[model samples]
Target: MSRGTSEAFFDVVEWAAEQPWSSGKVGLLGISYYAGSQWRVAARKPRGLSAIVPWEGMSDYYRDRCRHGGILSNSFIKFWWDRQVITNQYGRPGRAARNWGPDTVEGDLSEEELAKNRQDQNIDNAANHFRDDPYYASKEYDMADIEVPLLSVGNWGGILLHLRGNVEGFVNAGSEFKYLRMITGRHDLPFYYSEEVEVQRSFLDAFLKGDDRVGWSVKGKVPPVDLVLRKGDVGFNDAQAEKAYPRRTENEWPIARTKWTNFYLTPDKKLTRLEPLHTPPKKLSYRALGTLEDPSLIQFTTAPFEEETEITGNVVAHLNVSVSADATGPTPSDIDLFVTLRHISPEGKEVFYTGTAGDPVPLTKGWLRVSLRKTNPDHPKHRPYLPWREYLSTDRLPVIPGEVYGVDVEVWPTQVVVEKGGKLVFEVASGDTQGSGIFLHNSPEDRSEEKLRGQNHIVFGPKFSNYVTLPVIPPKYGA
Candidate 1:
């Protein structure tokens, strides 16, 4: 089952291996789609495949790309398939500036020729396949099968496509010499930065040129991890000046001295460290299929912090909720919830980050369908970072009407420094039935247009442990 891209490239590698004057040892390297394909091809363990450097590309088709938190992400995919992939078709204009309107050094192209040149991406109606069916599964290549020396490159700003996969690849690969190198910057910024390029050169030299003294083989003990800390307050702007100074490195993934803070959600919509009141289970209900302007989302916020708190690594929100019974039109069989992390400025404005919308995109986002809330025990845990989602068909546990179910959602990994007096906020909604929508609703969980109809009841009390486990990194005051 070939993924959407070219699988024949790997065949070329095999052919090159058997050449009359070949070294019989091959290494793959590229950025974006090129980087993405390296993972898929390396999984086959083709003869002579020695190394791979997947710099900022998606490794998983289902969870990482097409669908997020079990909901179909239509907007990004549609635009990607239509604009970049489609325009760059054989006869159409390649990538162009937004204001340029697809007309650049390449001449204007005919709509007909462009149509004839375009190949079916098969993602036109991606919303229909919510789970990892044969379609998405075929596109994914298991990283665990890759046994080559790997230098998985990633950028902290690669929240949309590469961050998680890069980390996962380094952790799961069968290779004994896998290393992870991450820098802080916009998606393409690190690719051209001199320091980042120098690092890449050394890795390539050590592996491809057999210069073992330069790469991980040197001394047999350079911490397998390298990262650049982002500077300043809590905004996630990865773009940086030529000299953003203060670059440093740590030995491992779980940064030292990371204090995990669990904030409990009170019935009164407050985020507090103290436990919720000992009263009976409290509920916040919203119309099952309400419109954007309607009262649909329930938000909880913590009080202004007295000091700055730098949060990095993963943040998990465990929700204990239930859906009220209803036999109305297209009654919902499960609940689809969109969870977003936000920072409130002292003056009362949502602080936007780099990823989503330009103004103040969510610091991070998470999604989940109540029916598939179960976790896999065998899934080697990433601990406080990634919640091992059991996406298997057998592992999915259905939601019973009026039954309380616990769902764990992983907010994308991020780096932010919340200054004193700043507040953290959590917004919850059964569906994207609000102006602050993160993903377009098309999956079975989305109760939009009366599709999966049911009132969402968020229960919070002693038994209903509704809280967010945040990896809080306090300021290095003495350092």
Candidate 2:
């Protein structure tokens, strides 16, 4: 039934055996499907598979790809499996099998038809195992057993599946030589085909090829972690490409420089820097757009700034929220929140950073679906906002109307230096706002204008309240 998996494993093993090596050091390289497969072979502890470059690959199938906080990440998985796995014939030119629509069970289909069939099968499987079922668990690999060095790549816009997994794997993996590199952009967009591939190649060369030219040293002895901000068009050429990549050597995950500040959302649509407005606990409810699927998110902005501010760290939002019974369902509501930094020019045109200063700047950006609002008790310091720990025990708590529950959303780690007079903004909404297109409601079958409705309440007071903690790099005096 799973001949593909067995065949793929042996193919790599065969290739490894042919490699000329005084020391058994072979690295696995590829994106998505190839990267995903490496995990399976790596788990077996292949003799020569010393390092792995799992670009945009996930360790946990359930949390990362299969189910997004219990809801199926249907759109992403269905499309990927069809394009990359099912119909991928692998060096063959034959058409894929089609089984998606009502008519075909013949198993023999055209490439296009097979693609559609594969998509259908993927979605059907996802829908059937909608709950955190065994099928989902079966696909997941045990992270504790992975013993090789890993170089995980993550994207800021891949909120649906890839982003969280990269972060989680990089942090949780027991590998002593694990490194994380986060780049901003869409998930499927070319990382290998683009100049950014140099960064990846350097890592592979150093770890796998034993090349001392592409050393991981950067003035210090620390974990080689980088958070690359995709500015825009002005990227590094072949010569300076590898050197230009962002590198931040750190002793731990979610770098220590970050400061977590809780910004409270008010009923009047005002984002205040203060704590809870009152001690009695207040709740503000808005009319849920009822199509609870993709509710309108909230955007918070600071008054236009006059100086260049470098915000480089993890961001989390603490919301004391609730849902109107008339609006949503018994199942917990899932939505996405985004944090953006924009430079409002004197002409009032907002210039978003797409890359670095010398590189093209991004127009606008966001992170997504951070369901865990509670902080990990082991490393809870309201000072640096690092929401790395997952609180799996509190999954059943439902949001009640007029009731205040703390909901914290973690924004991916980023490094952006907003110039003088630019505005530092945070937009919290229910859906993806990066690309403008047809809006996708959560569930297509159970289409209901009423079931989608709900309201979010925010509480801000002195002691128990709302604020945003920022990592302020103190000025270098007398430099």
Candidate 3:
């Protein structure tokens, strides 16, 4: 994308509205980039923009697309920028030949001129680490400013990127008739599903054409949330099986009746509801800067569930952690924490779900740069289940050796139903583990040896017990 993208779209919307055949009420629709652009343009409050369906699009550019927990998501950014953005750039030669689009109407720009015009997103993202920095702050817009009717369809498998923004956008947008719809399956296929397409048409018809068949035009007539439950492992990337996973309606995101349960991490590697007490503090160490190829991590497993249990919504892990420098390498300065939630079946099989790229994935993942761990408890978006951090340059905390820091890791929201005898595993790793797919945080500049390479430890005891708070949803009355 281009700077002033929303403005450009707004101009086109205005022009289309004035056309002879136009209805004067335009609706925005699409997935991914098309979906992402809607948020920005809707916030601009474009004339004739009556409604929007931002299906599987990210709302926050900096937090959602470029960085994950203040660590640069370099891999995906590079891939997308190179394959999608640059190849489709205006005035780029050979586009028509490559089936990318027609060659520039104004003829192609010289390679030198093209280089001068475009900013390399990969390089810029790695260089800018804080949201408060100009590079990110310049792209910021207030979600609350958007007053259009919205249907934000988020993908359960979009754990690495668009999922957070969809949830956050729906929660923050100022639209009086805003609704959230959650879905599953591959990112590209779900949007084109016949049932999903019907939803898009119904919403647009309700707002744009005054066809209020679904009662969408009437306030409070329809439930504000529609959720697709990931009940069982239908196997990853199986569209047909995932479609049978069942659906439900709720009045709000996070489901108001959610039972926020804490599963304590014990020294014995068990995850229990009861907090451990009166035990000597024990440290579990893992080599820092571990990669997917050579993972160094610790796991805490819950006892098999005697009955069916449903885990849904956002998750947070409160850990008592510290780090020490290795004998020979440069002294460590910061820590990057990668946490994954995995589902295990009664027969001891790990259930995997479809990821953003159709790869096998765990339940969900979360990350945090320890130095940027200071959270804003007073922020309006802050919740007991979710901590909101500004990721500002001024919020940096010292990460001295031997100093233990109690930090909260915000695991991406997830949904999984553990069957009888099924288990849930909480994994804490030094770097990107399985299920990260192409969205790895391996930028050398961002995770330098001098800053993050060391021995990372999770201290466990009564005073320093670590626990993952899971949003356990119980059966609703009269279901």
Indicate which candidate wins on lDDT. Answer: 3
Q: Please, what are the lDDT tens digits per residue for candidate 2 over residues 1-479?
A: 12357356856775765678545677788776666666667766766677878887765665556544343445555555556566443322344324433333444456675455433545554455322344443455556566777888775445444565677667766676777876764344557455567867777777766773555533234355666643322232222443354544455556554444545555444554564345554544434442224446555556555565556555555555455454234433533333443334534565533232123333333333334444565653333354533434353344334555555554444455555655555554544443312212245432223433444434544434544455433222331
Which model is ahead, 1 or 2, in terms of TM-score? 1
Compose the digit string of candidate 1's lDDT tens values, residues 90-197: 445544554424454557567887777665553433533544566655676667888888888766555555677777777777787888777654565567778677
What is the model-wide C-alpha lDDT for candidate 3? 0.89
Give one digit per residue, the lDDT tens place, for model 3 in 330-365.
889898999999999998999999988899999999
Candidates' C-alpha lDDT: 0.68, 0.51, 0.89
Q: Where is model 1 more than 4 Å wrong at Cα?
A: 1-6, 16-25, 90-119, 122-132, 212-215, 219-221, 234-238, 241-245, 287-295, 325-330, 345-349, 356-360, 381-385, 431-448, 474-479
Model 1 misses residue 136 by how many Å?
Answer: 2.2
Better model by TM-score: candidate 2 vs candidate 3: 3
Which of 1 and 2 is the better model by lDDT?
1
Error of 1 at 291 (Å): 7.9
Q: Which candidate tops TM-score? A: 3
The C-alpha TM-scores of every prediction are 0.81, 0.70, 0.98
Using TM-score as the measure, what is the rank order of every candidate, best first?
A: 3, 1, 2
Q: Which pairs, if any, clash in model 1?
A: 234-417, 332-453, 352-360
